[model samples]
Each structure stands twice: as C-alpha cells, then as structure tokens.
Target: MVNEISNPAAVVDEETFSVRRTIRIAASVDKVWRAVAEPEHVSRWFGLVALDGAGVGATGTMTFPDYGVIPLRVEAFDEPNLISYRWGNDDAADARPDVLDPEKSTVFTFTLEPVDGGTQLTVVESGFERTSAPLENLESHRTGWNEELDKLVALVEGEA
Candidate 1:
C-alpha cells in the first residue's frame, strides 16, 4: 500500500540558485526510477514527454500545457538510482534544437534510494541564475517542483 505524505515542500537555495525537494514514495526504487526516467512513464505525470534515446546523451522535449516545450538533453543516467537532464532556460513555443544553448540551460536531477519500506526520492534543479530572470525563474520552478512532485507521488501511489 502507499503511504501518503501530508505536505511536500520544496526548498530553494539562494546562494546556489537551486531548488530541492524530497519525498518518500510507497514504491520500490526501480518503480520510482521507471516513472522518472522513462519517457512513456514521465508523460503520465510530468508532461507530454518525448525522448530520442534511453541512455545518457539522449535528447528530448517535455511540453507542459502552460510552459510549452522545453528542450532537454540527458546528462546522466545511472539505472534505477539517478537520472539527470539539462534543459533550455527559455520557454519556447516549440521544440527548437537548432537554438539549443547549453550555457543557458539548467540541470535537474532525480535520485532514488531504497528506504525501509519504500523509496526516498530527491529532486534538485540548479542553474537558475543562468536564465534571463533569475529570481523569477527560481520562484516559478520552486512552485513548479512542489506541484509536479505532488503529482508524481499521487501517480506512483495510485492516488491520481
């Protein structure tokens, strides 16, 4: 059964300009990993996600209903433990690989660890200061992570 969390809060780091959130999921590490790493599973909770490849060095796009399509490239993939991506800083209407700029991208990581009964999931998104509006972007992502992760938890727990 899924143990539901009351409130999942995301912490924002001003010095590093990063957002971090942690939550315990009532699922196995591999289950949580598939939800976050796999494109098909990700689209169910996060957004309309499409990835070119599965392993590291893969490129993809996640199109949010409100935020539109954000170009992303897989930076790290460590099986069911960790998966990370660097996404474009600007929110464009369409996926634009031609104008993809790494310098203006932000890195977000999903890490899963086996806990006593389930898995401990941690998400960290950094490099917000590189965006056009640092503070605005930080605040936006801070809220975004909390809401998005809540959906993740709900989906994983079969509550959604």
Candidate 2:
C-alpha cells in the first residue's frame, strides 16, 4: 500500500479567515465525486458519514475519531462536480444535525474538475472567523485536509 500524502496548498485568506486547498487526485471525476459526494464512499476515506438525502438541503453527521460528531447540512450539490456542506463551527459535544445554527457553522466546498489523466479537486472552507477559535480551527483543518485527502487518493487509486 502506497502511503502518499497530499500536500494541499492551504491558504488563510486574511480578509475572511478562510482556508482553501487544491489537490490533484489520480482518479476519474466520477470516482472522485463518488468519494466525496456519497456518504458510503466518504466514510471509507474521510470519516464515518451518514447523510439523510442526496441533494441540497440534505442533512448528515460526520464523526471523526478525534473531533467527534459534527452536524452538517448540504448547501449545494452538483453531480460529479461540486458538493458543499455547512458544519458546526465549534467543537461542542451536543452538536446535532437537526439543530442547525448558522451562527455556529462554517461552510466547506469541494469542487472537482477533469484534468489530464485524473481530477483536480479544490476545497475551500470558509467562515472560520465566525467560529470560536478562528486561527486554531483554520490550522487544524488545514492539516486535516492534507492527511485526509492523501488517504482519499490512496483509496481511489488503489481501487483502480
């Protein structure tokens, strides 16, 4: 098994305090999209994901081993291209998918584009300034994306 780590270019926008990373995956857009958009595939690489629906307005919970369960709601969904979700801003123990509070949430978007022999996946996690610990959250997620995306690439490419 190849343990390739994806060095995502994480940038913290000074104006908005958002974190963004762009990575290239050695997989088709459809395959990458499935790994990102579908709850079943997501759980394999990202975390334990459970979604209520497939399109926008869908709700779900993603429980990370260290971060616990975070409330999430789908904000945008474009098949094989884009999928965005708003998750709880703070690491509160009582976070629940049914209790959505915009004041306590940040939005993360995944955009995929077909490239030569693979897909270009860009992730932008915005609204960090709205969270309780802006800088900490930004740094943590920056590192988290790098590790998780690396796992994603390994999983997808290994299957191919």
Highest TM-score against the true fold, candidate = 1
Q: What tens-digit string does per-residue lDDT give for candidate 2 at 72-93?
A: 8899999989999998847655
Pairs that collide, model 1:
none
| lDDT of each residue in 32-124, candidate 1, tens digit only | 988999999999999887888888889878888876677878999999899999888555334364455776779999999999878899999
Let me know the TM-score candidate 1 reaches against the reference structure. 0.91
Question: Best by lDDT, which number?
Answer: 1
Tell me the whole-model lDDT of each prediction, alpha carbons only.
Answer: 0.84, 0.83
lDDT of 2 at 95: 51
Candidate 2's error at 76, in angstroms? Answer: 0.2
